[model samples]
Target: MDSVDLQVLAAARRWAAEGRRFAWVTVARTWGSAPRPPGSWLALRDDGRVEGSVSGGCVEDDLIARMRGNRLGGGQPFILAYGVTQEEAVRYGLPCGGTLELVVEPSPDPAQLEDLAARLGQHQLTQRQVDIASGTVTIAAAERGDALSWDGGRLITVHGPRWRLLIIGAGQVSRYLAHMALALDYEIIVCDPRKEYGPGWDVPGTRLVTTLPDDTLFALEPDARLAVVALTHDPKLDDMVLMEALKLPAFYIGAIGSRLNNAKRRDRLARYFDLSEQELARLRGPVGLAIGSRTPPEIALAILAEMTAVKNGVAVPLRDAVAEP
Candidate 1:
């Protein structure tokens, strides 16, 4: 789920806890040019209040008007489609006759909302299924590598931290990386056991863990949307975690070190941990795109850029593959 969906879910939970009635509108399908993507959510309160968005204000305005008029007060979950024509699409700000489909469920189940919110807060990917006809909800564990799908009478919505980053060190580079990652809506967790480096580790939207790196990786169980980078340059701190991260399904696993140091680390992993050639190949030794990153912030930028590219399944350019010496 994206930040918008998460925000809507959070607001829904708060409203439900306060004993307020509301509905959740989700943009599940779109054609041509839609303002919001699939999984985008809007929380509508009983008093015609809203927390999130599904379109470029026009659709929301219409929904709000309907809510105020009590037209949608009926406790029925149904699908809504708008902008079916070119003129209608243009009027609604959807370019080129785009059509958008929404699943509007009235008075969404409070328990289901809370359960999804709790799972998201715990950084676990969760699948929420809602039966339109029966108004029943089922929550299940989502497979890490699979995309969300909608089955007959059941809409599966994936909820969790959208992306995760586990920084193995709380140094200047880690600080820079954390800052950038937070802006990109990644849930960041920094691990550094050394007190000197761990102290004063304050970054908004990131969790700082002063636990052993290896233990942190074990606890995190890095997911497919997760990236782990070892920046401490300390074998005892970085190596063990890097080894563990390499074994996980994390999309990106890297270690910050010089070419020579990286070679040595690879040799050590192969010699001691019995890492196969394929596993070793997965480790981004030098870490980050080249981009002539000389300073900590610059290096962080390169690493984040590479991570973004990998997440989007884009091929990094050759220049970005190696840093300039």
Candidate 2:
């Protein structure tokens, strides 16, 4: 599944292929409270078609009007500010007197769009830098820490997955989780040393590693942007991952099992593996929310839901498997 930015880039490329005129808008900066964050993308076709969004309904409407009237960027790139004043904020439907500075490209280069899309399709984190004065764009490799930078004359936006998810098993649940996480713009890496499991793994957009779980964890060099999930349900495999993962700085770490199974796993880690209480506290086991999920897909959904909540800094109670009747 393509992210909203990738979808917007695809739409722009499609319009270019069909010989259509379109304007591309990026939320370069925001003040107070804005609907979208910096680097949000929106494409406006000449016929009022829209892909993605920069603000609530009102901002898109204004962009559509400007596009239809041939007044968006006046044949070049320009910065358009909305909701600067309290009254203007209400008029534009911006919340809390928020303001948005958007960079509009009257005629974005089709070649540039295609290049960026190709790089992202190859699972490369790329940056597209646009010179606001000339509409000239340059594409380059980007690091995970790179962020969107707007200096009033240049706008640089990072594209592709900034977050990473490492799954220790390539089973059905992991397949579903990896597939779903791709839509959220996460670079997925699935590790399974068991030869039997490697042959059946067919999920695209995820890299499968045959190395030991601990080796995979070591190679990844877990950071705040990384998340590790164990789904093998094998103590030897899952515990191997947690032994090293819980010691790292990954933002989220989880393992799939029932409540009793996770409890045992935690005890084993503490007693044998020497995982600290604080480190073990970071492990989210019986992973996912209490969504009463029975099937593999539902379980995957719950996992992603919980992961999203944690990533957003939302306080979610620990999820435990309910006792069976």
Candidate 1 residue-wise lDDT at 45: 90
**Runs in model 1 lying further than 4 Å from the true structure:** 151-153, 258-264, 317-325
In the range 1-325, model 2's lDDT, one tens digit per residue, is 2378777988999999999999889899999999889999999999999999988889899888887887865567889999989998998999999999998888888998888888877767788898977667789999867978999999998877458899998888898999999889898999999988988988887899999999999997777778999999899999998999999989899899888989999999999999999999999988888989888899899889989999889988877673221
When summed lDDT is taken over every stretch of 10 residues in candidate 2, the lowest stretch is 316-325
- Please, what are the lDDT tens digits per residue for candidate 1 over residues 233-323? 8899888887777788999988887777888899999999988889988888788887778889998998899888888899764232344
Report the alpha-carbon TM-score of model 1 versus the true structure. Answer: 0.87
Q: Best lDDT goes to which candidate? A: 2
Candidates' TM-scores? 0.87, 0.78
